[model samples]
Target: MPAKIVVIANQKGGCGKTTIAMQVGGTLGRAGNRVLIVDADPQGTATRWAASAADESSFPAHVAGLAAAGGKVHREIKKYLDSYDYILVDCPPAVDSPVPQSALLIADVALVPIIPSPADLWAATGTRGLIERAGDINTALQARMVVNMLQSNTSMSKEVLEVLEDFGIPLTLAKLHLRTAYRQAAVFGGTVHDLGREAAKAVQEVEALAHEILSLFKNN
Candidate 1:
């Protein structure tokens, strides 16, 4: 079977799009599945994260930069469809960028990461529209909103969660908390699993997310 394509995109910057793409892709790779991360963002953050890994223990998944492919990204990604179990495209935050649309065209699922804030929620409207439009072209495309950097204790976070419950996009049950371990993982060029005991909670969060996402494919 061809690889499952997951496109991580959000209209707002600082929503942790790269982090989710890397962590989930890494977790799947670590589980012995062949995984590839298509760095579709011009910023190349995903490429840099993999490059930061040490020679002895490089990032589990292959990182490929396809930012230059722009609107033709889906066509480019087609070349690797049979070579991996999963291909995750990390899209740039720019609302005007064609990368997200191109990616969604071929994606089995689209993961839209949103920070728990009024601004983030407002910005997500544009993404919701984009996904809805993409669905018309790619009828098989599914989309879920993954809440990131959530602070459960905060009243603002609570309010945002409440609001998102009615947000057009369905929310993922697994959420990422505001944790230092996530940042550490990027610096070390690996997933939360690489941080050892310090990232136990983060590890659980990411693993749960991976499991949930995989279940989507299984159910289909």
Candidate 2:
């Protein structure tokens, strides 16, 4: 069977696209799945994050950077389909970018992470449109909105959730709160899983996202 492609894309920068991709990719990899992360962002954030790992073997998944494949990225990614159980693509933050459009053409699911704010909500419309357009071709494409960097126990966070429902895309039940563990892990390499017992909550958040993502494939 070919790898189930999941494209983590949002046209707005600072929406934690790389963080979510790396965390979810790592979580899935640790589950014994042969996972590969395709960094399609020209900025190469995901590639850099993976490189920073102190021990490459402990990084969980394989990382590849294809910064400028543009429209041909879909074809390029096909080469890895049979080799990996899951392929997660981290796309550039621009709707005008061909990288994301191409990734969507081959994606089983497109996860759009957005920080709670008006601008983030507005930006999601474009990503949603792209996924909808891709579905016209891919037929089975599922696009979901992921609320990222959420502040805990705040009315603002609750308000954001209410507002997200206004957007037409389905929202993922799993969310990622703003936590220091994510940044610390990124700087030193490895994921929350590597943080051990002290970072149990962080581990749970990421694992939840991974489990929710895997369920999509199971249902399909």
Candidate 3:
């Protein structure tokens, strides 16, 4: 079976794209799925996170240079698609960047992680456009966005939640709470699943994401 490809992307910075990628991949890996992470960004954030021993048996991820691939990254990803149960790509901040666009080219699902706010919502418009453009190449691409770092009490968060509900994107029903555990765990090279109490909320959120992604691959 071909592995489901998930590209976590956002053109704007600070939207937690890499964070969501690592967390989602980590969750899937720890759940006994064969997982491969492709660090498409020049920064190699996911590659470093996997290489660090502090994260789950020190998994070393594949790092492919977009410039070197010259539109061949999709073929490369397809070659590895059957080797794992999941192939999650951690894309750069620039949605138009070749690496990210290539990620979309090969992706089965595009998970766009964004903060809950009007500004972030506005940024998603550009992301949607980029994904649509990439869709012209990869017709199998499916896109979904999740709200992250949400503060329950904030008016912005509430307003954004309603707005997104009205906007009708496949929004994750479970949200990631703003917590120090996520930050602390990442610094140690692990994910929310490692934290005991501080991770209670995140665990559910990631689990929900996994369930949602899993639904995409289900066949009648």
Candidate 4:
């Protein structure tokens, strides 16, 4: 079967798009899925993370940088479809960026990560427009929003969720919280799964997200 292409995208920076992509891809790979991560952002955040690995086996997924493939990216990624179970595209932070649009063209699902803030919510609207426009060309594209960097027991987080519920975008129940484990994992060149007992919560969050995404694919 061809790989299910998922684009981790948001128009705004600091939304943790790269973190989510790596975690989700790593989770799936650890679960025995053949996963490939395409670094589409010119900043090469995902590429850098892959490079920081202590060893090739430290990170679960295979990563390749293809910054700004533009309209050709959709067709370019096709060559890898038959070789992997999942392909995740780490898109640029700008909605106008060509890579995001190109990734959307071939994506089965677009996972938008939004931080719990009014600015992030506003940024999501622009991303939604980009996703909708891509939908005109790629009819199979399904967009879902995931809350990232959420602080538990905070009123701001609650408000963000309430606002997003009315945003007309499908929100995933698997939300990622703000935690040091994620940062430590990034620095240590591994995912939360590689962390010790201190990262158990972070590991669980990633696993849950991976399960949710797989379920979405299965249903679709």
- lDDT (0 to 1) per candidate: 0.94, 0.89, 0.75, 0.88
Write the residue-wise lDDT of candidate 4 on 1-220 in tens digits: 9999999988898788899999999889888899999988889888888778898677889998888566678777988999999999988886567788888888999999988899888868888888899999998788899998999799988988898998877999999999999998888777898888999999988888889998888776
RMSD (Å) per prediction:
0.9, 1.1, 2.5, 1.1
Candidate 1 to truth, TM: 0.98
Give the per-residue lDDT digits (tens) of candidate 3, residues 141-217.
Answer: 77788888899898879888888886645787767778787676667677777778768877888788777788887
As for TM-score, the candidate ahead, 1 or 3, is: 1
Pairs of colliding residues, candidate 4:
none
User: How many residue pairs clash (N, CA or C atoms closer than 3 angstroms) in each of the candidate models, in the order given?
Assistant: 0, 0, 0, 0
lDDT of 1 by residue, 1-220 (tens): 9999999999898899999999999999999999999999999999999999876257899999999999999999999999999999999999899999999999999999999999999999999999999999999888899999999999999999999999988999999999999999999998999899989999999999999999889857
Worst 10 residues of 4 by lDDT: 67-76
Instruction: Tell me each candidate's TM-score.
Output: 0.98, 0.96, 0.88, 0.96
The residue ranges of model 1 lying beyond 4 angstroms of the native Cα positions read none
**Ten contiguous residues minimizing lDDT sum, candidate 3:** 59-68
lDDT of 2 by residue, 93-194 (tens): 876789888889889999999898777887788888888888899998888888999986888778878989888888899999888899988997788887
Residue pairs clashing in model 3 are none
Q: Against the true structure, whose lDDT is highest?
A: 1
